[model samples]
Target: MPHDEAQARDTYACRLARSLHNQVSTLLGNRLAHLPGRTTPPKSVHTTQLKMALAETVFRKVYKLGLVPKIIAKLPVLSLMLAVISVCWLLILPMDGQFRHTYISENALMPGQVNLYFRETEWNHVRGFRDEAAKWDFESASRSNPQLEGWLSDFGLKVSHHHDPQTNLSTMYALMHAPRGDNTEAMVLVAPYFTSDGQKNVGAMALAPALARYFARMSIWSKNIIVVFPQNGHTALRRWVDAYHTTLDVTAGSLEAAIVMEYPSEIDNFSFMEIVYEGLNGQLPNLDLLNVATTIARHENMQVSVQGTAPQNLHKNDYWTRLEVLARGILKLAVTGVNGKLHGCEAFSGWQIQALTIKAVGTGGPDITQFGRIVDSSFRSVNNLLEKFHQSFFFYLLLSPTHFVSIGTYLPSAAVIALLFVVSSIYAIARGVSAADFVASIGSVLALFFGIEAICLVGAISLQHIAISGTESSGAFYVITAALMLFTVLSSVGIFAVKAPRFSRPTSFLLLAFALYFIAMLIVTLLIVHFALAFCIGISAFPLTLVQDLITKTHGNTLVSMKARVKVVLCLIASSPVTMIVLLGYILDGGKTEGVLGLVQGLLSSWHEMQSWTWFVVALGWLPAWISVVVVCAFGDFTSLEKEKTE
Candidate 1:
């Protein structure tokens, strides 16, 4: 067979007969052009080159797909970190307790370790001084007390006074120098108008402020003390903190703890006064400090508050019995929009500020001097040279005085959310969806994101409508629904258009992310109409973009399905009956701090729960929905490659 074929091909050589060969070759070329052959094909090119090119293209697509995973991985790390930081920030960060966290730039300003002997140095006069000081209100007391400045200046202090018109806030500030001879180091000091029922301690408004100014000098500490009355409210206080801190180094470092006095509302005095400490997100004090303060204040057994959870009348070891006011009074106010922090307003203004509200108690005990001495002592103790408070627990849960859960102890709550993202990411990468499918997914994400934004906005506007109509808004947020529908339509059309291929997908997504983040921050900033309401709103609105990228990308077809919609609605409905309704009703009640706290805690938990439920639907139900969508859109280049092959 081979011999016969060879003989025939040799006989039909193009070189042998040119004209005859040309006619046959032309016909052969025309017919064979559609066949995969090498006679007239691009033979000079390396198959390796073609292989490499195809491989490169495949790799590029793979690489592009990997970009999403790389970005997605960050979702877990950042989200977990943020939630963790928030928790840590709540603790050791300081609050209205036996002492607040005050910043000491220098290591030397020992506050109360001297032979000033304030204990035996006139315990009786605190009441008289306090009563006399109470005679004048904030304005009168401030006007009458110019010497307060001169006194700090006498201690070799450079002083500044801030007069805030908004919220009618005023403050007096001074920084003490290191001792002239020993010259330990520099520090700051501040004391502003203490206005409560137009009265001070007993006899201190006019004279005690002047003399109280002297206590900083007598401290014999190393660091300078910047005592300030950052008032006019939280805003003014926050402004002052910004100005003050700006005057210092502009870098990330530990801010020394701060102390703020709130004797404004002290009329007489009850038993041991309550020390209200609310760390950022239910953070508590350092265990060492807690123990020390408890042992020293004699009310070590007094109540404590972290976040809004304070155990009522908590007793530990039978000896150290501190009252844990379960019903958060002042701390609750700060958490639920009632900023009871005299100087706490400054913390939000970019000053890592915390405070301690130590007021005198016990019928008629611990006058201004004693209270001042206690503060001075605590500050002096802090002044003792030491590294940052990194050794103790930064994140912990308070069960009692001695028991606590460390950061290592309680990371599970945040970890659970992060884990879901991890699983979703792995699946998206392995599926190897095509570019068109990718665009479809992204379009869906865009719809979802804009849809969410529209819903939230409309609800906000409608709420405003009701607020103006009477004071409260009713019914579901209709505007949000309309916005969602409109955006969904827009997104769907945009993805389906002939122009979709023109724009660089990555660039578009990047630009969109930037625009959204900016818009979010702007909306948050604009809520300053009512500081309290603004704070509440700002928090509620600020963190949506936190893990949004992860959440949106995880949405396959299951999320947008009719069945999924039913589940989502059922979730919404079930949420109301079980917990959301109760919370919604409570919040609707208005101005109820306790109710609000309870509601918020529940709502937060509920929101988290809903996210988990959504994740479940996404992972389990999304496949079915995605398959259905792909089947329906098979001709549109949106089906899975395997499905296309099978068809």
Candidate 2:
């Protein structure tokens, strides 16, 4: 080998070895600098720094992507998941070790700490009241119960009579002024002359006056007690409350709290009592009032129940029963917002005065005398309250007298369901459908909805046109049925009239979807603001969501297909006012004959009289969503829709 070639090869090899050493050193330095707990920077740390910066940038972009509309579109499923979780949470409320026993939130409410003095003497007075009440007819007794007035006056309290010429009803209230404080705030004890079901209030009407006399003698009262005797249950109470708050003819103060007692003549004794805390529009009294009432009743050894059922002590053995009771209570709470006569306390709720009703059902155990002691104890507890009720939960559901689910726990269920609709609506709007097309589509649906509702309302108002000279019950049933049939026929005709062209099909479907979402938003707002109402309507109206898909598959250009017709029938049957009536009748009347027909008749009458807008809201608010879905199904074309989208 040549000397010069050997020298060049050795030089190249040495240079390559030095370069490899430098590269290894750089890698090692970077690795060491990136090690945990190493504070010092390496000379060649740019690679690691560049990798970290890239990772951070990726993370930032990913976070930003989450806020986009496509991500927002996924919220409906998320809301559904949340709703399911919330419902599960509700069921857990009745589980073992899941809920805390209710306690007095107001330290001043020293409930059950005072001794009650009512005895056999109070019983004698109750008997006298019942005898006196039996002497008069409903009309005369309702107009002027002089015996009651005389008996109340004998107690040395100021008694006054209120007559509403417009209603042809009367109310009487006796005031027992406070000895310890001024008459700036007062508590009311309401005794309706007639039960909500039109039965005479034998026990409460008699006992309330005697109790008023008893309370008038007590010197420890800081707030004046007003004993009220309204001619009837709901309407009379509203009139009296309105007169009390508005008219200066009767001097009265702001109402702190109120208790309504309905002891029917048919029931001599009740084994247990249900505490009805839910009032009109789903308004709840301060949790403290319910706690105090239950505590006092239990102190008297009375079995306490909620929503017409006694709490079972099965200890994790009766999970489903408790859940059923809890569900029933929620349903009742939901319906309370419809301004039914289910609870007389609903009247006071409009005035922001906390109120509750204690309805004694099925006669068997606690007679008037024993019940008087419970009442006495409750009043004593209320007397102990130093300030207005403000400390306890204003939103809650009583699974039993002891266990409850608060707003924080149960609100998420309805909220999530409501949000699901909202997400569906936003997605509807995002489908490139024009606002004009959406509005026109909705207008057609609204026209049908409003037209049906108007017809129903007009028929209800002009029931006299049905000249069926038969029995009142049969006549009402026939007339209402005929009216309902007419409405269905008219609504069906209107649905057929709103037939959209192929181009308008997608727009109509999206419009209906958005309207549903808007309704869901309203429902969510209702759930947040008025939970019972929202839950009641939201749960029942859930079937409306299925109509769109059902119709889309069953119809094309016309609802002539049997499948489409069946879907339409199902939608109407499931979401109609009749369904609401049946559900309400089942809950309120246990599905008795008089209950179902009576509920329907009352709803019609109330709607006519403008006393309740619940039926209107149901017919108008829900029908639009329902009809729009039907319209989409009858007229939409999926193939054309997809083609347009691609173009």
Candidate 3:
């Protein structure tokens, strides 16, 4: 009975399986019959065909909905809007609650915890030294200064001088070994012989030695103190720093921090202290170091300023004041990064050493002794550190001395501006790809792109060589002239290249797209290391988005209208590298010809001496991009080229 029942169940299961198989086969056959070919596909090809059909259905639905192509078409307009929005976003960053209040992230940096003791005795010594230093010729007193070296030695320091054979400049430095700690780390006190503006730094020369004397009297220091008197300019100091890290005869220890004193004015008092913190290529010292100085100054009831913000306005902290301060900070950072003008402390950069300058502002306020106390307390706080400054913000935008916006808060603004170029690039690429001769157009465009870049690269190398060989005045002229000549050559190439019979409208579009994409990538990479520079360049180049290959069909014969000509002129005025440099020189240097020349010379010196990439980036990336835009605009209507061919 059981065997009969089992046989019945097995027969029912087999019947059900066959019924399901027949149903699936019938459905598949009907689906396949409706396919476009209407032929039985091999078993291996059947699944692929089904997947392709599904994808085609989805793509068709998406296309009918008009989403992607519509967005791509409007990308240029959207990009312009985004550029404006980016500026607005930056302005909004200074408002309350948008930025963070400055705080000491490292507990070891107890800035004002120590007692203040720098006083009248030290002030007397500083006065004496200042009077003596004022008598010496700072410019001619390079290789030997017996008076200054004698004073440093009197202060119980190991004094030595380093002379660079190439530049014929000299740097005299004195080291005070720490009595309480090991000689594995040291701090720097730099008193440049001349201010960044080429004025004598008499007060700083006196103050540095007097402070070293005071530091010698105290046994609380954990890091050895090195007093440096770099003659000629910041370059001398940079050379000294390089030698210290590499080949200096006298060794102290690894440099961990530096404080540059710039008391250019002869007066014993000042309005306020200006903290100069921008470093080479937009690098910054640890925020804790800046906060330490600020905190110590405030603790002593002295006014503090950053980025040249007036002391009176710093207390207001209103919307406009904050915005102005923010603008000044950004502009200063951009200028410092590009021009390589040293503000006394930027020389310590690129060596993993944190540094800044405290410059005495105006000629009336806190006595010089108070500034001494600020330095004294600051060094004392630094003495308390167990390790290097690692726990504070290194990348930040200062809204005020007491408030800041870090990278996470402010990077998006620059990123948004950079995105405009990317959007325009994408739109151009899409248009170019849809053309019938895409392969030929892309190949030619790439060749043109690389050709222009090659010219720029050669120009950059030539500029560097000129900078190295030429003097300050003549070097500036040579650099400017060389750059203009290169641009003219590039513009001529672009104009003539587009007029060739083989170069089509698609080629122009592709070339412009390639240039825009390169610029966007450059800005993106710069944002990581130099946010202010990236933002400045991105905003200045925003006009590139307006560039397009204007094509209009009129009757049978083709001609460029007045609008295209106007666009070319406008783009040259707004986006040309020459125009931008001239405007920046006028605005920042008060339109003085010498000031502009000095700026150019400074840029060259920075490139040659410190290996700053600003000149290279401008020469190679920015100039080429601008030339490509001009070329595309010069292309005009494609029908004109076709008519010429027929003729």
The runs of at least 3 residues in candidate 2 whose Cα sits more than 4 Å from the true structure, single-residue gaps closed, are 1-89, 265-269, 310-317, 337-340, 426-482, 485-503, 555-565, 601-613, 634-639, 642-647
Model 3 clash pairs?
A: none
lDDT of 2 by residue, 1-647 (tens): 22442333334334434454456557656776567775775544667666655655554454444333335345455545645665676767778776557888888778878677887767777777777767668667777877778888888878887777757787888888889968888888998878767788877877798898788888988888899888776777777887888873765577888999988754457766777787755678888888887887777777766766743442233567668668877776655534245557777866778888887766676677767776777777777776778889888877667777788877877776676566556644444344566666666645654565576456444552342222245666656755665665555445545545453554665656655775796686677567766766666666565454344344455545557657665765666555666667766776576565655554544432224445555555665555555445445542223322110
Per-residue alpha-carbon lDDT of candidate 1 for residues 1-647, written as tens digits (9 for 90 to 100): 12432233223221223333345446545544655756655543445346545655654554444443344445545545644553443332222342222222233333333444555345454555555555545565453356455655665656666654433545666655445323333323233454222233332232234434455447355555556554332444554665454643322233455554445544433334334333333334444444333334542223332322323343332212212321122224324212222334223222333343444333444344544554555655655655433435433434333344444433333332233323333333323333454555566545544554455456434433432343122222233223433443343223323312333333233323432333334323322221222222223322323322222222245544434333333322231211222343244445453443333332222212111121122112221222222111211222112212110
Stretches of candidate 1 exceeding 4 Å from the true structure: 1-116, 139-159, 164-169, 180-219, 247-255, 264-269, 276-292, 298-312, 316-355, 359-370, 386-390, 421-436, 443-567, 570-647
Q: How many residue pairs clash in each candidate at the backbone level?
A: 69, 2, 0
- RMSD after Cα superposition, model 1: 16.0
What C-alpha lDDT, on a 0 to 100 scale, does residue 160 get in candidate 2? 89
**What C-alpha lDDT do the candidate models reach, one value each?**
0.38, 0.66, 0.76
Error of 2 at 544 (Å): 2.8
Angstrom error of the Cα, residue 279, model 3: value is 0.7
List the candidates ranked by TM-score, beginning with the highest: 3, 2, 1
Q: What tens digits encode model 3's per-residue C-alpha lDDT throughout 450-501?
A: 7888987987787667766775457556557556746654563354245534
Most accurate candidate by lDDT: 3
TM-score, predicted candidate 3 vs. hidden true structure: 0.86
